[model samples]
Target: MVAEEKTEGQAAPELAAETAGRRMVVLEDFKPVAFLDDDDRASAVRRYSTLFVVDGRTRKGGLGRVLYAENAWGDRLAVKVLTAEEGADLTEEEQQALASRREAAFRREYESSRLLTGIAGFPTLFGQGRIDGQPALIMEWVEGQTLEEARRRLSVDDDGRLSPLVAAAIGRDLFDLLSRMELVDGGLVHRDISPSNVMIRTQRASVEEQAAQGKFDLVLVDFGSTVLPARASSLTVRYGAPQGATPDYAAPEMLTADVARVADMRKSPAVDVYAAASVVYLLLCGRPPFQLGGSSTGGEGAEVASDYLRKTTELPLPVRAAHGESADVTVALDREGEAVAAVRKALADERLSPSNQDLKEALVCVDKRVGEVVLAALEPDQRHRPSAAEMREGLAGFVEAYPANVVAALQGEPLFQDWSFDERRKAGGFEARRRAGARLARWAAVVVALGLGCAAAALCSGVRVTAVGSLPCSLEWGFPLVAALALAPAAAGYLVRWRGGRKRSGLVRGSVALAVVAVAVEAFVLSATVDPAAMKGLLGAAPLACSSAAWCGMVLEYSMSAPSAWATAKRPAQGVSGKGGSV
Candidate 1:
């Protein structure tokens, strides 16, 4: 009813591919082996630090193969490959462009896969490398049943329904992770978390122990499809306005299906909440709320039409109509008792979540084992989400309090993060380059100045200076060149910086420009002066300008750390070590 019924809008991204002959980095360690076995034929496997078998087809029917590697300790993990083969069928120029893209994709995957190992409830990275020369990263093999499988087992129809309580626990746990992620790292977004990503294990809770205990582990996998950007719209790729996760589990924003028109898809952490809510809905009712078509594993639409958008409602089957699998949702989303179009829009449009109350009440109906402490985290506002450490603590405490009746969710939090590691690293790298450039620029100025002096002493003496109308100005030919020399660095630094990131603030940019201006002016006046001794003295001070720029760079380096000892540490290093170190 929302239009554009298909969940995934665009076609899947093309696989990267190149010809055998043009591939400069040839497959060196080519070997062969079988998948599940004692005996097998020689299947050409690309080997570097690991093995690459780009057979393409996967167990789930995906377009990739397993990358095997052993780390320093020789621990093995599976790196799910995203093939370049989709591009193999392209033209020459396209192939060349794809080579660069594949490299970036590899780097992004490696870095993101490595970073995610820090968060809780995620897979671990064993190793990564170029096998047969193609880049790959090895990681832990998550062995469990996807939530989709669990849904099929529990749901009355393929339109999986989950009780609200189960949905809340899922929501709370995910929110907790997101908060920790915000504080820890900011580079990777698990862009493709769907029912398939959520692994579920079932345990028997007998009739006597109706609400006895539920113990389970949820592992989020498949970084292969992740959007590994420094920053992105939490709304779009991860979550559409209503639906941040996947269309099936997507919130109302995703339901509306209007967001496709907006080129720059952007959303927030709550974007995931919608999908999270959908997951909760599935857990409570054994099926998702809205039924666009069916479970993403490929179910028919009419059966899953009941996968209602969050806080949305259709017809709750009467108690008389109830069967073992039949369930009801009083999740009448609008206080206004709005019309069909309005409700659809609300479910599909970007929601302005003011509080967690709505999501919280929805969860209360599911299970009692869920803690209020964790539920307290399900607030619609992202900042309010409990930190991963805090969530871990809460989940741990709940188990301690309700040991007999509760089981843990995920075993450990990912160590891949704690704070903005990428941000800090990027900021540090930028500051270092700028300082080095400024230093080099300053060194260049000095070299040019010394060169001019040497040239003047040796070459200019013979070149007759026709005394102009003003004899005083005749002595100033060297001054113009000095200004040009000194100004170039800051200019070049600015030029080198096409666009400043969070680290390069306006104040810093302006300050660097001013330092360049001030130095150039002073160098010009000093170089052209009539008094030779004054020029020598002033030239010695010119290095101070370089030192000044270097000091600013150091301050930026330390400032990103927000260090109290920065001022004390900065002056000694930048001004002293590299001040005249290069010049």
Candidate 2:
């Protein structure tokens, strides 16, 4: 028989009884209800199953918070439970594998969450008892503002922006504390650092919360996804992107499953950086960075909306747009747009980063420690990424090294030779200029920061189109210095570049030059204007240094990319008579 849901005017139905170990199990089932508290004119109805669900929409765990809860003790205490049954019903082997997995997960939750002890406000482990019919574990109930809530309470301003200083401080406290758990005694990565797991309460009752047996002060709850022995090396495969990373927080690696397959998931920390950037974006912008404003959970809805807005909107990075002035104005529109786009790209995709200029600008407004913590995890190449152990050591150095001095030295560990440095420079003719430019770029950054005010604000004010072909040459020096210094071995690369390939005619050189000039100008203007000052700063006063240095290296990267020029141009030439009397 089809069961009917309860009506707004009806009382909650009592549950049917079933036998347990000794006691009885009852399930009243979830039903529909109407809210009476609303104004007389507001008519609203929702489904609620007495099977123990608390708040419906807000309570769901998609964002890492308690999603749906069952009230065991007259509804005062709520518990979130997920069972293997919820997944696709498995065959014998699948079921056994699933059972084994859940068992290990339950045990890990009990052990790690139990150890949170005095550090980091965490949920209290209540009791673990087998239900009469089903298996369930009980934990202390959490109440008050989630980080999202704090954002909302403080979000009265229509814009929903938090000061960079305030956002950074909050970010620092949370990360510095979280870093302490990188290895968590032996080896464990929180694996999931999205904002929903973080909670900041208005009332901090340390003693009371302890007395109540729940760690409720600025607590980070919901460790259901924490990595442990039985846990998969990557929670990202299942809980990432739409399910967890959410469009705004989802890293490029976490986005497409295809790219994910080719890349090193376990080694790439960009996944986490993407999440961290989203959090920073939300804290600073009020609205989550990439996700569109609304109840769009992680899904195509959020992805589509975020993309639309990102392409059209002027939302600046919290580091730049928060105060409205740190950014500059005279930079030109094309440049400003490019800069913003770069900042957006950094937050969305790790591969798009390595922007020193953008880094400097972001650091200026962002919390010094927050910047440090974020960088400690960002590297496009998996090999260059810091490990949890490395992160621990780096963090130790960070806290002890007078926070003021961290930025100048905080680059990801130098790229390995296998990464091939020199092959990147010879492509562009800016080899020597690239080196000179790197220093000046850093110097110009200080000047811009000190003398010009916020380059971001300058971007917001108006658009300034840069001249094509020839650049100021002074603005883009920083990138090449590192690439050149790093690739001194390839100093004679240009002389040897055409060594093997068909000799280049003036037309090919002109074509390549024109193409390079067009790309450089566009890249620079875009990079300088919209990308956060921090990101822009990294590019320095030059154009694509590393790529320019290693001509072969650059081509290799391009080779794997979509359709190439050589392939298209050479396709038609293949028809040119193979023999003397051919066609």
Candidate 3:
């Protein structure tokens, strides 16, 4: 007998009792639930039974409930079972149709699992079976949160956007997965590629080692919407065009209004390409490339309906149409030209703009090339979008540019590259500029303070210039003049730089001033009389002069070497790569 459904927060013993005696009926060769042929109907299908028990808690998703279960062999599994609305009435025919639909969905997912079993980034399937009269799939239980959950944990910026560097890494993994999918039987399209469908798990060896290397594995799941292109025509006729895909991430082509006209076009891998780009865009900026009415205020259903309308009846008027250039506007343009025009108009939609400034700031951490690639992938026309393989190639360059140090910084719990010189200033790139300005000010202040202190000491020591090339050096006149010359260069240079003079000009002026001071000091020391007492006085003056000059030169060098204007505006490439796909 079937056990009664257990409510949430039930006692452990009660939960165990609820799962007792559940038999999983596994078929050796599964057949389609609908349109079963004679061969499928006549055979006594080979089958087996496995006793499995649900343990711990249950997790819910859009289409099903997932619970942790262990088979008779004590191997853990994630069993996804169909979920029905609590209260609904249906006629006999309606009930059977729903049952057939549910069964077909289960079979489709099972087939996809089998097809993708050996592919990296996907979980291995155990088998498909029935539990309490509901279809369930037994697959490897991945241990980690969904990518959506990971975002909240990994958000390290002032705004909640994930670092574009990290997002690019994730996007690269996604494109790699898609590229591998293309190799299977002339390519498979995972029509649904949303955050909730991707799992983020640590490939834990040693936490320290992995953090140092900056490695984590992303596993793609929920393959029920997977489509094999060769069978697309039959599937379209049977199941309708533009099969189930998440609306927010779905491509413009996937949501076309006249499904019949684009049925052939739907078979291309471009749908997945668009969705992958949208996912990367969302990660970088915290919103999709396009949304209805400037936001998702009206909810998902409205957005889905609006997307269909936008791609069809409500598409923008062409450039020629608005200008009234011709009475017969459609006479000269071909299909490709119309597509190009439509794409241009679509790209101009304000809704397609990033919802926040986070994207611009995040762009500071990645190559401009990465941003270009992402924009190209989000193209409205499928022909304009690069293949998944191409995207992977474009991203390879920038992804390689992120140094191991940046990865190490990212791996710490804080999730920010605080140690990175570029990452530290990536938030609007203003902080670095501010710091640079402050450093210059501080250096100039130090130079002024030290020069005053040295000049005061020289005056108190009673060091006087004894002569000036055959003229007797006056005690009062020569000392003050020499002090002024030594101090004038740095002081004037600081003022000049502060007044917006070029750094190189200030450096040259300071160098000239220092040279004159050096020559004056050397001449005074050499002209000193042969008496030890007079030589001692001259020697003291030389030390004082050298100290001030050394300190000033140090400050000047630091100022001249300060980061340039470009450092604050554009990030240096941390890495390099051949041309390839971008985020």
Candidate 4:
């Protein structure tokens, strides 16, 4: 009733001939299609006299085909046609049944579009009709590239990731939209929230204004798979109604066909929360946090299934058995329930592959609070996930912390603003890089202290008494004694560093011990062969030795721990801090 009824004797509508292996319904240009007035059964019908198809604008999806078109008055629009060719191997009766199912889905999409008529960020419905005996729905043509394209562009510089600030901004926008959907009567759930289903559109402003503001709008498209909570039982809970979602982004509850759990979750916003957080995670970490167990052999659904079992139990279903097979209802439901529970528990415990701990470490490198908010949204237990409003508030904190001008500039091509690992290191955010610098500075200071200590020791011992008015000096005791003196400062520095609560590396302690023992042995041999009176010169070097030792101790302690200590200065009281006191 949403479209005009077909009348007998209407000439066979023009349709493009089907190409081999491509299930597309490419319509010829200038084909006439009829759209009914908004009233469900309005007798008045608006016939599109000259609908011209835009070349190179056709997009094929599993459910249907989308294409761009214009009418007689040159009003541009997007047309979605419910047409797909069943496998050639199917009998005529099977093909007819499949066609009927697709037609029903098409009508449901039209109903969803009508329900979402006034929501911001959603497409405006133009009309609905039949073309060449296939169902078609026309809507406002949104001009923009898919989020997938934007993500790909931003990932060019950072191992397939975007900056934390950028991801936060986008995430805020998505949650804001989801919050709006929650307010809709009966509540709506976008079961499919993949990157391709989102659009990034620049505002209709001048190029100069765009460059100045760098603002972009996010649009949630593809309502065909969207569902209202009340109607979910008739769809997903019904056996044989395949879940309409990309396996990678689908939540754990959605991975299995557990009727009770799936039915109960239909109204929960947490389902979309998991998906949105996964998208944000993908942007931040360059990969999904969970690895599909049997992805190599079975599809993603099976991989998630195997991933769940592998985490929860020693034995897992064979890739083939999990893939799909005709089974009795009782057995199937039991399997589905177990899988759903296992996945939920595994995810709740943060036991999935590429563990949450690792993800947190990676995220903390960028911004700790941002990581906290994202992980909370990814909480496996629905009760733990923050409400939509809470998620928006959490993300808004970091998004607002960023300068508007910088965000605008970064949104442009080439991503003028970036937060790669090297850039973060330069900003003093990378712990490893800071540690490397500290190590170099510490070693250099130790070497300098050693050289100075040896020189001072040599100067003190080389002086000698001589005939009245003649100044006399001797260099004979310098080699062995000075060598011992140099090792003394290094050993003292190591002790001070170790005493400051710094865990000493084996290498540092070993090097200091080896140098001291070796130098002491040589000094003893030389002293046994030389004058015993030369040892008296050491008394004169006492002040210099003490001062050099103090300096070495301070330098080594501070330099060795400065990197981590300085980075965590603003952290909580219980956080790890530098135990080495400042000079």
Best by lDDT: 3
Residue 251 Cα positional deviation in candidate 1, in Å, after optimal superposition? 5.4
Worst 10 residues of 4 by lDDT: 574-583
Per residue, candidate 2 scores C-alpha lDDT tens digits across 1-583 of 1234533444433333332311112222211122245442122222222234334333644322333344333433334444553335446776666555555555555556656644555665533333222333445456665676565544323466443434544554555445555545553434455667676643544322321221224566655445543344433222223232344554444444444363345323435544554575676666554434533233454554454345234443333234343243223212223213323333333322435455544344333443444433433334433343333333333222222221222333221121111222232234335434543543343343322223323322332323323543233333333333223222233223433222334224433653455364436445444223444443332333322434443233223332323212211111111122211
Best candidate, TM-score-wise?
Answer: 4
Candidate-wise lDDT, in order? 0.39, 0.40, 0.54, 0.53
Candidate 3 lDDT over residue span 1-583, tens digit each: 3333222222112122343544342322333223445654333122112335444456764357877666446666677776652315566666666566555665677777778886778888756655555667777777777778876655443234454455666788889999998998878887778888888766454222222244447788887667788774322111223345666777766664445556556667998998888787776666666654423212344554677566334422211111022222232122113212322232233123332233222223333345555766776667656778767755654555433222222222222221232332253245446546656755665555456636644654555455655777555334555455444444544444453333566555555555565566556556653232544454535434544654454454556455555333433444211132121
TM-score of each: 0.39, 0.41, 0.51, 0.52
Candidate 1 lDDT by residue in tens digits, 144-209: 566677555433333454332233344445545555444436534454457776664233332112
Candidate 2: TM-score? 0.41
Model 4 TM-score, all chains together: 0.52
Weakest 10 consecutive residues, lDDT, candidate 3? 317-326
Looking at candidate 2, what is the lDDT of residue 308? 36
lDDT of 1 at 378: 36
RMSD of 4: 27.7
Q: Candidate 3 lDDT (Cα, whole model)?
A: 0.54
Candidates, ranked, TM-score:
4, 3, 2, 1
